[model samples]
Every structure is written in C-alpha cells, then in structure tokens.
Target: MSGNSRYRILFAGTPDTAVPSLDALVGAGFTIAAVLTRPDALVGRKRVLTPSPVAARAAELGLPILRASRLTGDAGRETLGRIAALDLDAAAVVAYGALVPAAGLEMPRHGWVNLHFSLLPAYRGAAPVQHAVIDQAAQTGACVFQLEEGLDTGPVFSRLERDLQPGETSGAVLADLAVSGAELLANTMGAILTGTATAEPQRGEPSLAPKLNQADGFVDAARPAAAVAARINGTTPEPGAWALLEMASAPAEEAGERPAQQRVKLLGAVPEELPEGTADLPLGDPLPGHLHRGRTAVHLQCADGTVRLVQVQPAGKKPMSAADWARGLPEGTRFQAEATAETATEGP
Candidate 1:
C-alpha cells in the first residue's frame, strides 16, 4: 500500500483476464470500494452456477462484490444507485462484459478507465485478441483508455506492445497480456492520482472485431494451409475449430453402418513442408480436403499447401494426438469442406 490509500475506486470486470488488474490495483494500495462483475451463470457440463472469475477472486480478497449483467434496466437502476453511494474517484474496467450506461458513467468523478486488449482504433470490439490471431497480425498490444459510451472509442492514457510469436494462439497471447497490462493499469492509476496522467486521441484506421461464433470456428480446407492454421490457432480453446470427418466406409465389424460423418475438433494445427525430394511429387500435392496419414502425423491438403493436424477431439471423446486418432481411421478418410458464404479475407 502506498500513500494513494485515500483514492476510492470501483473495479468492474468479469473474466480471468480481469483478475490480474483487480489484484494489481489492490496491491498498489488504492482503496477498492467494491468490485462489479456479472451475476453467476451456469457453467460446464454439470450446469453448476458459477461466479465470474473476478467475483471469485474478489471473494478471496474479501472485497465487496456487486454482480449485475447490465447497467441500463430497472435492476441497473438499483446497481447504479449502489455505485453512486460508493462515492468513487474512478472506476477501472477490464473485460467487464456489460456496457456502462451514461448515468452510471457519471457516478465516478474521473470517469471509467478501461484496459482493452488491442491497440485501439483497431480491433475495437469484443474479440480483439482472437481477431488479431486469426488475421495473423505481426504485432498487437493493449491500451488503457477512458471509457465512454462509444465502443472503445475513447482517448488512451497508456499502451504496451508485444510481438506475436510464431504459432501462438490467442489464448496464450491474452494470458500474457493480462499480466503485463495489469501493471500498466496500476501505473496509470498512480499517475491519475498524482495529476500526471495524460490521454490522447487514438490515431489509426479503425477496424472491428465482433464476437466470434461457432460458424467462425468452422475450418474450411478450401483455404490456404496458412490460413487454415491461423483459424485453428485463433479459435483454440473457445468455440474450437472443427470440421466434419468423412470416413471412406464403416469398419468390418459395423459393415452395415452408414459411412461415418463425425464432427471432430482440431485442437492443434500448423502449416507443414513436404518431405525432402517430394515437394514436386504427386503424393506431396494432395487435393483440397484430402487426408494423408503419415507414419507419425496426420496431414490435410489445403488450397495451396498441407497443414498437419497435431491434435484432435472426436465428438464425445477427450482430445487426442492426431497420430493416435488417425491410426484407427479407415482408408480414404478426409475432412469434408463445408461451403461458406465468405472465406476469411487477408489482413486485419
């Protein structure tokens, strides 16, 4: 705790990513008047009611917790009143999920400061990190900005940049950003208290990163191998990338069964180079969607090249290595490419 103990701030966020910022603020010695997170919701296969990650962490910190899904309805009025009573100097938000209404925004003297995961003016919606990974960006960063009614369109106080590692998934990048960005948020708060904080208008061509859906996770083999690999990595661990596996025919034990069309999730994938001296061979140039099962790995042919499947999860089964999964498949098994309305365009 520093001399900044007198500053009372409301912490608003709801995910594991937000937990770090909350912890940082408390560790930095500011008074956390209360924590605002979404209400508990059913989670996992057991349908157990689960608090948001921030709520759970706040409980461990013995901090007051206020759960609300939104700040605009009748229930929101009650939440707003509760917030107003706190007499907060400012509110810090990180992946809060719900938008703050105009009335609620006015409750804090310094307004709300948000820690957004992307370099604003670009990837400015719900899925910034995921969209950046899917777009195969060379670099991406986080920004601490003033939260306004406009969608992440406020002036930024501070930012930190990190280069995208080769083959890194969105989940991995975000986890790292959470920790570094937490420090940034804490420092920004310190600057705010000392009257040294400065925010400038964002400068860049704005781009949108709308929330990704199940359809966005569909892996189309008609795309180039690099694109397919990017999509798999981008959506890993959430609405996971998947494709329909079309078996050549039923096994001898189930001879009468219709050719199996199983939906399988691709857990790990990467573009691969063909074996030495085989780059120009027909075996190395498989048609789109063709499955080439090698001795230890399973490869899929894409529009321009081959992508190796490192891991896969069959419906109703736990994830397994692609080699292990491919060993049991019948010959001529291949991924079925679904026709999509639009293929993913290049760049962010």
Candidate 2:
C-alpha cells in the first residue's frame, strides 16, 4: 500500500538475516499485526534455552509474535485462518525456515511476499548465500518476490544486485543483502499497495540450492587446490569445513605428544601460485596434503598448487591463526584427515 496507507502486515522469519526488513517496516510506519517465528530452542555454551533471533527482536520492538513449527494441518490451519482474519494487507517472509502452506498463503488480502537472499531464478533455495560464496559466483543479490506454493519460484517484484567481494564470508554477504532487501521491500511494497508494483517472470533455467548439511563441510586434500580453498571460505563460521590429522604425524602433536588423533577445522586459507620446475609434469610438484612450511604458512601441497593456511582450530579448541599454531609443529609436518585416510584405503 502507499506509504501513508497504515496497512496491517504479518511478518515471518527466525534469524538475524530477517531482522533488517522487520525493522524497516516498523521504521517506515507499517502496521505489523504479528511476527511468526520458530519456537525457542536450546543452544550454546551452557545449553540454555534461547529465543529465535527474530522473536527476540520482535519482542524488543513490542510486536506480537506467533511461534509455530510449521503452518500445516487443522491446528495450523486455524492459526492461518486467524492470521487471514486479521485484515492483513500483506504477509512478508525472510529466511523464515518453514513452509507457509496454502492455507496461510491464502489468508492475507495482498497474498504473501518473500525476501530471498539470492537474485531470483539463481541460487533459489535454502543456503543460497553460502552456496554462492562456496561456488565463487561472480555476483549475488536479494530478490523480493510474491510467494507461490513452489519453493522460491515466484515472479519477482524487485531485485537488487551486489558484487561478491573476494574472500567475503557468507555471514557478511547475508548482512549486506538483508539491509539492501529491506530498502527494496519498502519501496516495492509501497508500490504494490498503491497499484505500481510489477511482477516479472524468471526467464533462465532453474537451478537449486539444497540445504547445507554437516557433512557438506568435510574437505579432502586430494581435490584440486582451488576447490579446497573455495570450500574453506564457503563453509566457515558454521558447520565449518575441516580435515582430519594423525597425531603422530601432526606438527602440533609432535612437540607435546598429546592426543593420538585430532580433527582440525580450516576456517580460512590463502592460495599461492606454484613455482616453475617444482613438478616434472606441467603441474607443479605439490604433494597433496603435505605441509611445505609447518609454522609461518602452514603451507600444504594440493592437487595442482599450494594453499597457505590462515585460521584453524583443533577439536574442542579455540580458533587461532595458522602462524600462531605452527610454532609448535615440526618443520616438515603434514595435515591428514579421516576423509583422506578413507580415500587412501579405498584405493583409486
């Protein structure tokens, strides 16, 4: 509706990524009827109960909230009915992490809209932002689209483009998009309410971004160096990508002779071009997973090149830079992980 229409809107989301749009609506004077967020769950150091980030923010802003696992079935249907009966001009979702179903989708007078983290028709699904970084996409952006029953295939109301800076973390990219999407939403929604909003059909071939799982972080040194480096940057900060190590061969383990085995997460890395004449073949003489420099660089030989390790953390240990941890390792230490070991045993 117009900026001055004083329309009632239902907001749905559950994480930090959704906060910006919610805040923008309040700031722009939209009448928010209720915030629909996930139920509180146990989390962190002491395993204490914690509210969904969206819920916490909504409470802070004095907005009513509707917490539900998913809006389905008769019980959920009743909730949807109530939401629809609220005379909401529109319902908006951003990273809500649940399906709205047809019931809720039909409730609002203006239907539902979603603030997806990727450019529409590209990277359309859960984990789009993370996948974009991992895949090294040239660019990524946010798209505000009217929600259909299908997943993220709706016609776009508006889209904003953003460049994916080198070595940008997924969290950073998401934060950037959230604010961008909020501004776009405020403008686009204002237009739709005032009869100026336009929806454009997605033209390119459809691609999917499946939800990322814990196993997605496992990194094997045998792959090409570029792939390994990309994986490291893509999955950092959560479900962190990592490799395994044999304690006896581990540089850190050699000094203290501590545990017999360990798992180390590679949070960050720096890829280096190979020197000439290192390998007899056209490729340089980098040995997969073998450390070239133990301390300063945590340098390792990959399939075709070298990667200088930056940040790392052993299991149950705080993260530290590779240079800091390398001091304790021997001069010729190597990194070995379970995935590599399994591959070795499995044979080529």
Tens digits of per-residue lDDT, candidate 1, 1-348, equal: 478789999999998999999999999999999999999999989999999999999999999999999998899999999999999999999999999988988889899999999998889999999999889888899999999999999999999999986567788899999999999999998897778999999998999999999999999887877888889889986768999888886473377765668899998687896555433236544556777777777778777678888799999999999989988987677887653314422222
lDDT of 2: 0.77
Q: Would you give me the overall lDDT of model 1?
A: 0.87
Q: Output the worst ten-in-a-row residue range by lDDT, candidate 1.
A: 339-348
Clashes of each: 0, 4
Compared with the true structure, all predictions reach lDDT values of 0.87, 0.77
Q: Highest lDDT among the candidates is held by which one?
A: 1
lDDT per residue, candidate 2, 1-348, as tens digits? 435448888999998989999998887788899999989999988989999999999999999988887788776777777787689889889988888887678778888988898887988889898888888788999888999999898899999999976656677788888898998887777777778888998879877888887788877676666667767777876568787665444645568765444678887765666444322233544457666543245655666567767788977889898768766665334565334533432321
TM-score of candidate 1 relative to the true fold: 0.92
Error of 1 at 49 (Å): 0.7
- Which pairs in model 2 have colliding backbones? 1-193, 244-336, 244-337, 279-285
Cα miss at 31, model 2 (Å)?
1.2
